[model samples]
Target: MPNCNAHDPYTQVASISIADYDYPLPESRIAQAPCAPRDAAKLLVDGPSRPIDAHFSHLNDYLPPASPLVVNDSKVIHARLAMQRSSGGRFELFLLEPIEPASYEAMFAARGPVRWHCLMGRAQRWRDDTALTLGSHPDETLRARRIPPHTGGEGIVELSWATGETFAELLDRLGQIPIPPYLGRCATADDNQWYQTVYARHEGSVAAPTAGLHLTAPLLRTLEDAGHPILHTTLHVGAGTFLPVKGDSIGAHPMHSERTVITRRLLQGLLAASAPVVAVGTTSMRTLESLYWLGAQLIDSQGPAALHLPQWTPYQTDRTPPTAESLQALLKRMDTLRVDTLEASTSLIIAPGYTFHVANALITNFHQPRSTLLLLVAALIGARWRALYDHALRGDYRFLSYGDGMILFNRNCKKA
Candidate 1:
């Protein structure tokens, strides 16, 4: 009794709901701590042909000999803060995103316009709105003012600083890095380094690009020495990545939008390179695929009569078929003029029906059940995800960010 249109198989699989993606994970398997030396973790290479088990230190062996590896260079910021109220009440603040410099608000369950909102904590005694003071520094003093709430259960707070310095500086002086809740541990001194990727460049993401966390400078040098190229893209990992799909069907769940930037030079390299393009993490894969779709749209519009003559009338068209190179040049020119370079917010949920325009192979960490990450994995390898997960679980391969990784090659890859 399911609708089975030839064009849409998703609607036909009634029993294959979001719940089907759920698997029983033991509490003990959760990696509360990361492996030392970062690259000392495990790696499980699962492909359509065979499964290879190895340590993370031997990662370079699995990559395509000389293929370029695209990496997400977004750096995690210290966003969590602690406050104490005059009433002797303590509240924990987990900074989601920046709204202002020194004085910004966060998600809290309290009603008032006062100087503080109480966050839920141990015992029922701490759940009351009380005057609180933040910052241990002598020059820093934060007074929180309650504001209107927003969607997704987030509440606003107005912050007033005692000093004239920008809010960012105050945060850097006081806030702690917000680690994942599952870690069940406070952000210690070691997290400042271990939680970050060796190639992290852009500084805005709240969460570390877990897949990139496996890459070290030595591995990168080895890749470069082997004639493989490495490109960097930015995708600020948002707190929403930790949220699970609560809907019955994966299609019914709404995906969160994340800001991403893919440079024109990187796009051109991907299009021109004869070597395969391997995405370092799912975040990088999303950025590449999103940009490729945008580029493809431009390519489709550059036909004989479809060209926007005003933008490219100065250039001559050769007899040779038009290529992505020319389009990339035009995009660069636009960028120099302060125009957007294929920039846009993407909520591109890569479920089964989505077609991949970029990325040949993916190096990623094992993901949680009923998560969007798993859907992406399923989309990449068809039914191989189940087998891969089962194999990893049985073989003692770690799971989740800070856990083991798998290098997956798309069987449906065009070149394959």
Candidate 2:
């Protein structure tokens, strides 16, 4: 692939290998169930300044009191489907992302026509050219026909549903929320709601924005009443969220592209707000950083509808120079056009040596070891991630999506 001048700075940064981000997480620490009344969960506040243990309910105390809190409102759908082969052998089908309309023989795995792969279960048993039918007919019908194969042992599965009935409607009836295998249980009635965040609105993601799951309606109301600005962006979480980096060097790892959207109004709000920007989850953080690097200005509304930022692409632009004001202006113009949102694909992976263009603080949950989430946490706080993980291990912070939360304030921003 040819390199773009816009990505030069990113290319110059020293890449951190996947091994540096690995940590020791006990199997017992992974939470199988959510804390009753989500906000009641624990929170571990760690930084170079000080490390403190607290409950998620006290999240406001760590904030600046009036800073803008940006969150990803992308909702998780029941993307997991159970299908039987011709021999009556059951296999699992997890929807990664939407490639085409639910009714028009849509594509899966990654969007676009060229790469339409999806992760399939029982790979050893299922042949390369297997087909699985989903849903009952008369009202609506859906089927998944396997196409060619791809790396990581996944293959393309073309989906088709009945006409007049939208894909969303078909999924509502035939699909199950594609929870991580680490959850160690079958989907239940509670999963339909517990797996999703209270603020979830956009319906495109296959995985839940776990960090946002800790927030409750009361907590949001409190933040709003306290004069803190809140804005939302959407990034449809894909199967890539769970793919582990296999290569020793970050460069060798294949970055998966996921769809993201940032509205002009949300951008304007971030620029105009007197307080610093705090991201609610990693998805929101990625969207803000990607947009900020794209020379997105309130004035660039008419130029393009969506922006694509691949992981290997540099996050800075010479014309833009990566500034908060410029990003805010870009978002403001989007808002003015009532283009509150812009959709694009991102393969950008945040790690150490990468400079953050947006978000001063983050509210996230602890992630699994050897996962991209762990690498992101390490990048946010430098080497302190190791020490923090050690602290959590000793202090009993539940690990993974349903576990405890953390409020990470970037030390680099403080020094700057």
Candidate 3:
């Protein structure tokens, strides 16, 4: 509970309170559903010059050939599981991340009893041995047993089912799509399709990487034709993605931990690419930036076989490798270990005054007020984020996960 995000000796900039990044958002402006013809949504392009208001269909026009687009291919799982207690009281369990295997792919493919860190809806009703049951399929019914709380309101939940279906498949059959709570409505059938990005492959995220939703198949094909190969890395966004900052200062907020996996191929592409890397969404941006710090840790430790990134690692660590060198060392370590993939979790809180090393630009959706996503924007463009948000609001761009998108230059990042 102390100041976890203390200022690093490497950073000379002063830290700002959470209040500095808060903005106004009208409820009516939040997009309840995605725009039809995904790429037809509005896109705001902010550069070193004036901001350009344009539609997403013209996204190809803004491409900087030097920076290839890196996207989060982490798929959104049907994380909301509803069940009734023995007393017939309805409650919901939203799976945040797996506590067992702790790997997104393994967790999804895992077929047996599974344990997960979850947020309970109507927690008080099911605090005792109530035996929550869910009728997932005619042939199979699922049951949940609550474990003791880890911390705060969330607790561990153990689940078992009779069907041979993997946990991911079972969730698909019975769980509801977890949507942005600000929508004030339940997920509809259409959301099962529209909420997912076209490139979604790996399943783990409780929420979709909304910015990726704007790039259609044709748009990607065009980007490829234009010589930018879209690369992927996975970061299973946790339920905390939507949680509001409770602390008065950004440093006091308990940053949510999310799992990220980067491949040897992905790292090589990132280093060798002639174009500056552009992260497709804040999730991707976080993954990309976290890699730098992760590699920095690797460099400092002489490349450990297993690596972990603490929530306040970035703020407190003075050991940082250059973007290219950090990535190169990571690649070498992975190759030496003969492992094709590097798996880790990040609780990184990207904020104003933070230095960026990977992405030169960010393509992200309009975020909630007082959210970490806004802080990432502040880190990228400084006070200009206020003007861009103002323009998006006044221009009637739909906001939130199912909303329009924006592109901001990494104009404020310090030279590596």
* Top model number, lDDT: 3
**Candidate 2 CA-lDDT value:** 0.73
- List the candidates ranked by lDDT, beginning with the highest: 3, 2, 1
Candidate 1 deviant stretches above 4 angstroms: 1-16, 100-132, 149-152, 162-166, 296-343
Question: Which of candidates 1 and 3 is the stronger one according to lDDT?
Answer: 3
Query: Across residues 90-174, which tens digit of lDDT does each residue of candidate 3 receive?
Result: 9888888798877677888988998998888888767656678899454688889888754555889899888999998899998
Find the candidate with the highest TM-score and give its number.
Answer: 3
TM-score of 1: 0.80
lDDT of 2 by residue, 1-416 (tens): 63445446554433456777787777899998889899989888874577899887888887886899998998888888787666678887776655444311242222322223467887667766666666555345455677654555476677665455556666777889877788888888888888999988878788899998899999999888888887988888887888887777666667688877667667678767676788998888887777765554333444455566667555343354446655755655555667555566788778766677678888888887777777777778888888878888898889888888888988776211
Summed backbone clashes in each candidate are 3, 12, 4
- Cα-based lDDT for every prediction: 0.67, 0.73, 0.84
**What ordering of candidates by TM-score runs from best to worst?**
3, 2, 1
Could you tell me the TM-score of candidate 2? 0.85
Clashing pairs in 3: 66-275, 66-276, 67-275, 67-276
